[model samples]
Target: MDMNTTPVLQLTGICKRFAGIVALNNVALSVRAGEVMALIGENGAGKSTLVKTLTGIYRPDEGTIELAGQPVRFANAQDAMQAGVTAVHQETVMFDELTVAENIYVGRQPCRGASGRIDWSKIEAEAEKLFERLEVALPVRARVKDLSVAQRHFVEIARALSQDARVVILDEPTASLSQREIRELYRIIRQLRDAGTAVIFISHKFDEIYEVADRYTVLRDGQFIAEGALADITEQELVALMVGRTVKQAYPKADVTPGEVLLSVENLCHPTEFDNVSFELRRGEILGFYGLVGAGRSEVMQALFGLSTQVRGNVRLDGKPVCVTCAADAIKHGIAYVPEDRQHQGAHLTLPILQNITLPILSKVGFFLRGRRAEENKIARHFAEQLELKAAYLTQNVSELSGGNQQKVVLGKWLATNPKVIILDEPTKGIDIGSKAAVHRFIGELVSKGLSVILVSSELPEVMGLADRIVVMHQGRIEHTFNRGEATPEMIVSAASGNELAEDCA
Candidate 1:
């Protein structure tokens, strides 16, 4: 990385506000050419606001932005792109109906001879070249709707590269990627650095920052806290800077004695997804399900939650057989599920936080909210305070909150249902360390109150730290089950990978 060159992108006194609430206060950042700068912050600490400001989605109320030592401002996204600045966001924004090649070069297609007709062949050829440069195999003619999450991210990166962008902002690029895809993305970031591109990498994972970033910029409560070389700072110091205190542990488990079984699933079978999946959740206990990407853990949970059809299973609550054929049936049986895809399945983003929290309980609180606004506000405020939700007000739209706050809203929605069993699938997947600790503490608090939990996670540390017992699945079948004191990381990973350990290994 070149250190002596002038910064490719620099911001000074960047201040932004929404309805008189400060989102960014005198936030400043600088990124030199050929270097990876890690933008570190907790959710709602103004990282997303800063990214939007840089990408031209939102104009700063007070600030000066300079590119290559020249003052400039972008009126819109197109203007920012034309000025050699681009951002590949976590939530991909692209036309699902368009092919990959078309999505990459949507507006700027090469023109034909003098007639200036659309040149389809050149577009596909250029897209193929870009994929080849990145050493990824993707069908250029395939529609983006059929692509996976990682594939969509690759398409966004290709688009950025195709535009010859000098400054690239990758916001949580690896959040949805598998381990192998994450390694590939790391290589791509290094390639961009080698080619003299200024990369602003934003992620909640510390190991990723330490691996790929050369410098660090920390934000705390909408203000700049620190900026320096990554090599000179320890991970502990960075966490302290971002959250203003020491987070001693990412997973905090509470001690609660397991009671009799509260929920039992026997021979849970989903046609073509999973076979003979069985588990027991006792009151005050957290039963964890760990597996690889396609291990069918989520499929089993979805079927149990009545989201899948043709599911053959016998579920009992407190030793009484119950029938759950759909979402409403499951809710009636005191079962609540927090889905992994929070945006699509968990929270109603267009609704206000108060409305979302009280949605599941509309049967009790009349749908006509004209006379029941006070009741709705009381319920929402109780959960919001319990979750420590950082939002402007109960009437604030869920879409306006950050990722962590959005997840909290979803969680509050389910908790408002007051279910006996809550199934949390990857609850803290994309949130930062501070928010993760808060969630872990909340989980402990839930179990202490005698609510059984079914935690389905791909992260090993989370499962091992919080689960009273773990059920490891491999290829849609139970590979092993380990008691709390018997499981090790190696044993659990091996089981998840379909490798059988010796009898004494655990």
Candidate 2:
């Protein structure tokens, strides 16, 4: 823990492979106490694979891992944690039925007095103490299932902190967080570093790294490419190192004439999650919904797409009244939705990529029970090509692809449905810049073909560049609508935060 001392962790000559895929090839990384060492690479570039090897999700094929100058091999994640290492992954793994406190201290619960029973009150009190230290305001007694994604993540971090970990790895922690939550997480990370914890942060976002990381290590094609102090490189240069090329503008935007209203929602209500929301999506127009997490944006999209059963709304498609009581009804009315959580609601991970794409339109192709293999393959191949999906073959499992490729599967699946209205929720999350651009361009093409798009995104720049018109939401209500020229990052943020436009917020 000395200021001028050795790194807390060092990995040299790390190599890993799965079947024929060489995931990490001699990757080297080091993390120092009181510093945030950012490990960044595109999806499938051995970032998660490397972390898994270190945390015992996979044993490295060849490598030397040292903690505090002594070599060590983690037999499992629990072994790593006991050895003062912990990781919070992109997806949270918490016991939903348990209380937040119980989830935080699942393995190491405090003992009660004479009865020798698990002390539930003590558990809640200890969790509250942890929350106080991390400045995370989560209800300790609340069921983990009731918490938002961001709150669950904070619980994970609090658990790690409670363990007094020497090295903590946070992988894409901000992916589900709002702007306010991101700033809060940054403060907590700074606190962790100041307390002498070596933080190994991983993210695809460049701006966040420069904001919070002290040193950066770039991995390319499963090999270490660069490592140095953050001050030594600019954002553009840092991106070049991480990606091995220049990334131009994020999206391909062109002027598209707005045609007739394709989809109209009036008095839409999902009584359980969100209520009283209304908006219009015009043909050849991208309508963006921007708000903080829990702003009910995704809920509104779900209601429109017929996922929530309690939805009450008047929906008009091409000026004709439509009641979407179920997903089939929505699809029958030419509506498609790509949900926010890809792992849970989007793709059928156990199935093949080809099956996922063609599953929606199988009946339409006149193939119901069996012997539809040829038609299914054709439909999948067409969309795979259109979306630039990279896969060894159509038969590959959907879960085997990287996050970006998995997202492509989701888009291709909905696109195969051939709907007039497409609703996308956080479509580009965890995807690389190239893939993000490709996805955005595909949205442009969809709108160009007279398809209406309702885009829900947390990235302000993305919304600014892609949306022809933006409808800001706050506290489950539409705050204000802005044309592309009228919206700025500041203005949109103000609206999303439920503040009157800053120029008039008084």
Best by TM-score: 1
Clashes of 2: 0
Off by over 4 Å in 1: 502-504
CA lDDT, every prediction? 0.93, 0.86
Task: Please list the residue runs of candidate 2 whose C-alpha ends up more than 4 Å from where it truly belongs after superposition.
Answer: 1-4, 108-132, 135-142, 269-278, 365-371, 499-506
Provide the lDDT at 201 for model 1. Answer: 99
Give the alpha carbon lDDT tens digit for every residue of 1-506 in model 2: 34368779999999887777787898899998899999877765678788888787788889899999999999999988888898998889989999999998998888878887998888889899999988777889999999877788889888888888999999999887767778988999999999989999998888899899998898887899999888888888877886788777777775798888788889887766777788888888899898887789998888777778877878899899998778999998889999989988999999999889988887766656565878888899998888888777899998878888899999999999899889999999988776787798888888878888889998889988999888888888888888887767888889888887643632
What is the TM-score (0 to 1) of candidate 2? 0.90
Expressed as tens digits, the lDDT of each residue in 200-237 for candidate 1 is 99999999999999999999999999999999999999
Error of 2 at 277 (Å): 4.1
lDDT score of residue 379 within candidate 1: 95
